[model samples]
Target: MPKTTAQLRQLWRAYECNEAEMAAIGFGPDRIRVARPAARAFTALAETMTRYRYFIRPADTDSYNCRTITGGTLKSLHAYGIALDVNWSTNPYVDHPGTRGPRFSPKPTQAERALDVKAGRADTDMTEAMIAEIESLCTATGLQLFKWGGHFGTLKDSMHFELDIGPDDLAGGLASR
Candidate 1:
């Protein structure tokens, strides 16, 4: 069932967080939005992986929005800033078979993510080892990694990750209509 406005608001206390508070965490120029707890966790993550700071660094990924799942009805965690998308441009969301959903009509590519910009793009060269480290760091930071949409089996969203603190929706983040 869909949560009422009051319930959503109450549940958002520790999650939805104010924009000003989010700015203090040093998420870079994008001023990426993340829950208070999640932001602190990412701070630690960035410190741990100082060498590859650029990779884990938050990009211009979408944050809060309100909407149902792509084809379903439910509240998405993004409504509370619990979920964030990183490197979306380079990491495509693929909807493969076995996930019980149709494939993504137009798959994304690293080349496109590059936007034909200069060299040194994070998505340009990623090795299996790098992915593993990122996954391990994420787990250590109290976050869950959702690769290829995980069990969804429908979308191979390689560039996505969620804190798994609440419901995950695709229609839009908590703020999205």
Candidate 2:
């Protein structure tokens, strides 16, 4: 439930979070920073992933980057510390056909994903069941739901997830979806 790029630009003049507004999730070297309002949700997600044995390597996970969306000028949710990427090596960002330059390729379809699994090109840990369970935890005391990037139609950033509520909605304890 992120806002449109125009809305985001208007809401956040610089699309940057102050250090005081950020918190760390996970442990030690694997920890990632995120907006304080979303720390609880991300913590719950990390715990859920651990419980489900969906191991994520630190090298492949990222959060809270101050950057624009890839291939676009708009600021990315990461700039707001509300987005995260997990196991990026196994679940890559892919453009849909005709959406990007010819150098980019279409995202894998269900059939292609299955083939990737068979060929050891992708990991099987990010199952629908795991996603469902994580999403279900959104209503827990201090947590909020996350929208999986896999659901994007034009481009597939399967490794990404972001708070499903906006900053204002989060402050108001409301969920957009």
Candidate 3:
């Protein structure tokens, strides 16, 4: 069944997130309201999350305010209300210590996750199979997907997807009351 905004919000709450974060992910504060199609897509993603143990992570402060994209150099889909991070394990790409004590090689560090840009690692980390599942469910509900994990070569955030159009298009249809 197609998902409504209320359904999407409920799904997010199932993951133990608060309303504020949900609002950010839904782009509710932006000029554009979340479209029904996109809401359907988000609901599918939430259902998909059950498989991964309700595994969506909140955006870190940096990611929340992140302004750069494309290898840490350009603006990211997050800034556009088109993307989100799943499970923190994959997003930051932390480099921890090795078997050796302090003698280990330097862990991967970025100016501020700056490494996320140079390589498509961010989108790539999300895995195509997972993204496909979300896409499949979304498509079944007639929702178009815009996933960074699919189109980009970097990290793959299977949980992340949105409508290709902007908020302007969302005004009509289910959102226009």
Best by lDDT: 2
In angstroms, how far off is 44's CA in candidate 3?
Answer: 3.1
Summarize candidate 2's per-residue lDDT along 47-158 as a digit string, tens digits. 7777666667899899988888888886787887878998786677766664521121123344454457446454333666667777765542344467777667676677
lDDT of each: 0.44, 0.66, 0.38
Which sequence of candidate numbers ranks them by lDDT, best first? 2, 1, 3
lDDT (Cα, tens digit) per residue for candidate 3, span 1-177: 334333333433322222233332332112222322345444445556556433343443122223455456644444433345544344433333332111111224322223443343342233334455655542333444444333323333333444444343333432210
| Candidate that beats the other on lDDT, 2 or 3, i.e. the better one | 2
**Can you give the lDDT of residue 47 in candidate 2?**
76
Arranged by TM-score, best first: 2, 1, 3
Worst 10 residues of 1 by lDDT: 168-177
lDDT, residue 55, candidate 1:
47
Q: What value of lDDT does candidate 2 attain over all alpha carbons?
A: 0.66
Q: Can you write out model 1's per-residue Cα lDDT over 25-108, one digit (the tens) per residue?
A: 544334456665566544543443344444443554565555444455655556566555556655555555465432221214
Clashes of 2: 0
